[model samples]
Target: MEIFFCKSWFRAKKCPTEMWCEEQAKAAHEDGKPYTVLVGSIEQPYCFLEVTRRAVGVSFLDQLLRESLSYDFQEVEPGILFLTMATYREFEGDTGKVESGTSYIFGRDGAVTLRREFFNPQRLETSASSADVAANYSPKPEFGRYEDLIRVERSS
Candidate 1:
């Protein structure tokens, strides 16, 4: 799967040229598989502002999709790929903190099969400062099955 994270317009100076972005979009469209162009914004974290489609035309690339963060995941399992991204921030003076994480599982066809998001509740509630929290913090293990199947036998 070809996944591109496009930066918003205000950051145009840091983005690729309009023509280059269009060429990339055109190539992805021609491949005829699952390709995603996600528009990103500074105001939003852990989510995309928009998912651009080919039908929108190259002109749309001018407005968005200029800067891209591309990722090419190799199949970890048969026909499956996994990706994870996280953000951890500690406020100045250890007054507060923010921790957010997300994971994605993609199929060989370039479709997302599973997505998981995690956040620290302490960040929202009145709790100890970041330093105090860190002193007692212990990372917890998360477990789950990515796939499940069921079979039934008919009684004669």
Candidate 2:
């Protein structure tokens, strides 16, 4: 097990020895505009070809059904993809909130966008402490052992 922290302003000023990895890919578009597509992964793969695939070629989440097919992704026919760890987090308070951490997913097509706090582990201020700042305050309590699961598929 391992712990990780976010690399934000607060985190940068306090701690300089943190690991935050980002993943990106070059997608070919029929329009000739090179689209940069990236996603978070939990494991390292031998090649990108093992992960990239088309919608018709791969399986996708049911929630993505309504998402614009032109921008969403699909799994590879063989169900092969990429895996990697994009970010990590630390305990912030008694409520189980993430006090400090870097969310690798963001932007329209970031590898690890969309942070949903389904379970409030901490009762800390949601606005007072920014994610980047919390990450800087202290290292993730037990992030050294946590593992993120990464899967790559064809860009829509």
Candidate 3:
């Protein structure tokens, strides 16, 4: 699975528009800002899950239907598997929210992570203002945000 972050991140890192920073994206959620985190499926039925991008402030809800090939998972249940490291989003996609969180990476063996998505009601209002507006991009039907994923990999 590939995850999509706000494209404006380039400006935040003082890098060229064509560049990306893994550290920057990993720490992006630590600020507690309200940001859109879109996970794209790399399969036949193409779709985008903005489950973690709700308008609420903190509803603490489950927000993912996951299938990962990055690591070997021992299924504790038919539909549930457990692993040690995974990515979590508790802040905005931008630098607006001050909520603090950290996303861990597995490095070599691959990461098995679960993101706990929370919803904010005030953010759903028509006039609600936030600094974490999602940047626009075209999602690929085959790999979702494949380019971003590659960038993260090469940055290592």
* Best-fitting candidate, scored by TM-score: 1
Candidate 2 local lDDT, 81-123, one digit each (tens): 2221123444433333345443233222233443323234533
What is the clash count of model 2?
31
Runs in model 3 deviating more than 4 A are: 7-21, 41-156
True-structure Cα RMSD, model 3: 17.6
* Candidate 2 Cα errors over 4 Å, as ranges: 1-77, 105-156
The whole-model lDDT of each prediction reads 0.26, 0.24, 0.28
- Report the lDDT tens digits of candidate 1 across residue range 37-137: 33333322212222122111111122222322212223244433322211222232322222432223333333443333335453232211111111111
Q: Pick the candidate with the highest lDDT.
A: 3
Q: Rank the candidates by lDDT, best first.
A: 3, 1, 2
Over 53-124, each residue of candidate 3 has an lDDT whose tens digit, in order, gives 211111112222221112111223342322222233354454334243332322223422333333553332
Give the winner by lDDT: 2 or 3.
3
Candidate 1: Cα lDDT at 149: 7
**Which residue ranges in model 1 land beyond 4 Å of their true spot?**
1-23, 26-74, 90-156
C-alpha RMSD in Å of predicted model 2 compared with the true structure: 18.7
